[model samples]
Target: MSKVFRSLLLITALSSVSQWAQAGNYWKATAKDGWLDGYVEATLLLNGNLDATSIDTDVDNGVVTLRGKVETDTDKALVQELVLGVDGVNGIENMLTVFSPGENEDSAIQRKLTDKKVATVVKTRLLVAPDIGSTKIDVNSSQGVVVLEGQVKNDAEKQRAVEIAKKITDVEQVVNKLTVSD
Candidate 1:
């Protein structure tokens, strides 16, 4: 090969290597975000004061986003503090809203009943679906929001569960926390 061709080939090889290195870094950052999400979830599950089902966490590029409702302001603060303890979490955006205290007893009861009904309907749909094994899944609903927590065999099962829940009437949102088994 001529000198010019040899130098051009060397430059092309270096460019390819640089691209691969950048891709690897991107993958590592993504994996770190996933790990942080899992850590926050597990911590919430273990906490006695915070209801894990009522809180959802998402992490992207090390920034954590907390969404959902809590019963009290103290619970909201507690969740924020607990999430800050997780390593690799660059920051937390706490979007948790406290349940309003102005509601009367009758309204609260009605809302509870409606939520229960929604949960029951979602569960029934999941049980009847041909692809989903409803035995391993748990469903909860509050204020038209459905929360699904359980382990499934694969990604297909997880997506099926979420779709089933979303199909239920009165279900305003579906928070899927389903895990795939190894």
Candidate 2:
């Protein structure tokens, strides 16, 4: 065989191998993303307050993009919390718009600010509480109502989450949706 021909053949073989590797990596990423998306959707469906049909989920490189509208800000926060618990999820992009037709922009912004403040305070309280595993807790607030969701090691942790949330000022109500791990 001519030396030039051998060189060309070698280059072609290397190129083919590189393309195959790239394709394999792409497929693996896609399959992993698909699995993560399914897991997040399943978790949302299991939550009674969430209408999974109204929310759309897409996963790319382990980052979840949530699109569509939820009934309240609490529902939007709930969706974020649920997706965060899924194993493969690295981050969440919550594009969920709270559906409030009658409320004007100013009022809506104010309400969101209040909810955020309440959520922040409660989360800080949970973080400082030695008895509660703050890492396992998810907090969401809407219109001064706080919702606590996640798994705790014992009933004491669950009750402690509720207590901390109740103690926060401007918290209209505390909804304890935490589950105790066996």
RMSD of model 2 against the true structure? 7.9
lDDT of each: 0.79, 0.80
Worst 10 residues of 1 by lDDT: 100-109
Off by over 4 Å in 2: 101-182
TM-score of each: 0.52, 0.59
Kindly list the per-residue Cα lDDT of model 1 for residues 1-182, writing each as its tens digit: 69999999999999999999999999998888888889889877876545779899999988899999987554565677667656677899999987853243477775675676567656655765688764789999999899999899899999989987886666799999999988
Q: lDDT per residue, candidate 2, 58-142, as tens digits? A: 9999999999988666567667766765677899999998896324447777577557756865775576567876478899999
- Which candidate leads in lDDT? 2
